[model samples]
Target: MSDAASRLAEVETNIAEAARRAGRKAGDVCLIAVSKTHDADAIRPLIAAGQRHFGENRVQEAAAKWPALRGEAPDVTLHLIGQLQSNKAEEAVALFDAIHSVDRSSLVQALAKACDKLGKRPQLFVQVNIGDEEQKGGCAVADLAALLAEAKAAGLAIDGLMAIPPADVEPAPYFALLDELAERHGLPLRSMGMSGDYEKAVMLGATHVRVGTALFGARD
Candidate 1:
């Protein structure tokens, strides 16, 4: 098997083991290959191995890579999983299938405006600062309800909530909180977890896990 395929198999094994430990079916979790820094050459093998969804962090990087990668891996679905600047909102809406880091009203407004111009609206997830960490770029937990109401009012399709628990704490409670918030708001698709804590996320009912290092080895 090719190197990337081997790595993908290993990741699938880990994900399956995680699901088994969580008493959930492996198919319940979706593994989004975090291809932020990596290029098309690095991701092609995963595509060949049947990975259809990939995530990128930067607008410029995605813009640079998608044209070439899309032609090669026509079935791949791209997700923008990073903090998006308003100036780049139009390009991001054009390039990504979903935006998982809508943290502020301004960003949402930009996306709405961009969508209006494009005549297409990509799925959106509000990023929640469940840990209340000041450094993170997410709406404060107290603000989520109002924000979700605003997003709905703005004609945005609120797919779910995305979060990154404080790096220093256990992620389970935080993830569960996000799931609760999503439920309260009548939203589905909890996009949480990473290589380190994805199993806990699954146990807490994460529909989508953003796995990076476990699938790609270590990043530089």
Candidate 2:
């Protein structure tokens, strides 16, 4: 019952059987338990085996372990999947509620001046290197429509489109080209897979699937 609650119920039963073979309704895919570099007692047993969406890849190691692990799991939803640094964009908009690498325009004008000096606007995602990987960390498949029109002309609340599809081949044609650039920028979230192709990124519509080593098994 506890290899991190049986690999978090086998990655939530393979993200509910890949959303029932893509008829799509296993809560339409959102399993993001990536807890980077594994601490907080290896992440409090996957938040006592419920795991309310956790991912971190350094905003000071999620400010050195998520404000006392989100003050003992107050519905933890921290994500900042990795690679961001325009002077830490106001400590990643005061610690991540989803910022999956908003790839550049001076880090979207330093996250729109830290969301206008810390009002906070976290759900952005632009990251699309899709396989044009010049050392990855996305934002140039023909510059994703001028980076989503410069992240919505700087008020920035994009709420979709991320990617990582070049490693070891066959990522469903780079998660179907980040689901065809999120249906050509009508954008309703994609944030592609991990842990060896998150059920092919939820059968290629991946509303969000940043799994880590199949729910925390391999990292350091």
Candidate 3:
């Protein structure tokens, strides 16, 4: 197997083991190969090795890289996993199959308008600032419900909630809190976890783990 394939296998094995320990099946958790910053050349190997779901952080970068690559590999799924600008809503809606960073009512309105304009409704995940940190790119925890309501009022389909915990502190509580929020709001997806703490996220009922370095190695 190629190096990327080998690494991909290892990550999958780790995810499976984590799921088993949590008494859940591995398939319950979706692994999103975070392909931001890395060029299409860096991503093709993983796709060739059967990695379908990939994430990119920027609309411009994703637009630049994915179309041609996707033409060659039509089944690849693209996710927008970063803060989105209101002006770029139409482009994002056109490009990504899922967007994991819908954080505010303004963004919700923009996405709703874009979806209407384009006649497509990509899956939307409401990003919560689980840590309540000042510099983060998510709706404050206290504001999540209102945002969801806003999305609903705007006729946007909200799939679930996504979060990033405070760096270096325990993430389990944050993951648990996000899972609880999803449950209370009747949402289905929980976009939590990263390279270091995905196992913990899985144990606490995360449905999607955004793993980067584990699959792609260290970024530049």
Candidate No. with top TM-score? 3
> What does candidate 3 score on TM?
0.98
Off by over 4 Å in 3: none
Find the 10 residues in a row with the least total lDDT in model 2: 211-220
lDDT (Cα, tens digit) per residue for candidate 2, span 1-220 = 8899899898889889988898998887888988888889988998999989988878998898799988988788998989898998888888888898888799999889988998878898888888887887788888789878887888787978888888778889889888987887788889898888898789879989988888878865
Across 21-84, the per-residue lDDT of candidate 3 in tens digits comes to: 9999999999999999998889999999999999999999999999999999999889999999
Per-residue lDDT over 74-152 for candidate 1, one digit per residue giving the tens place of the 0 to 100 score: 8788898999999999999999988999989998888888998999888889999889888889999899988887877
Tell me each candidate's TM-score: 0.95, 0.38, 0.98
Per-model CA lDDT versus the true structure: 0.88, 0.86, 0.94
- Name the weakest run of 10 consecutive residues (lDDT summed) in model 3: 141-150
Model 2: residues with Cα > 4 Å off, grouped in runs? 14-16, 23-31, 34-39, 42-54, 57-63, 66-85, 89-104, 108-144, 148-180, 183-189, 192-204, 207-220
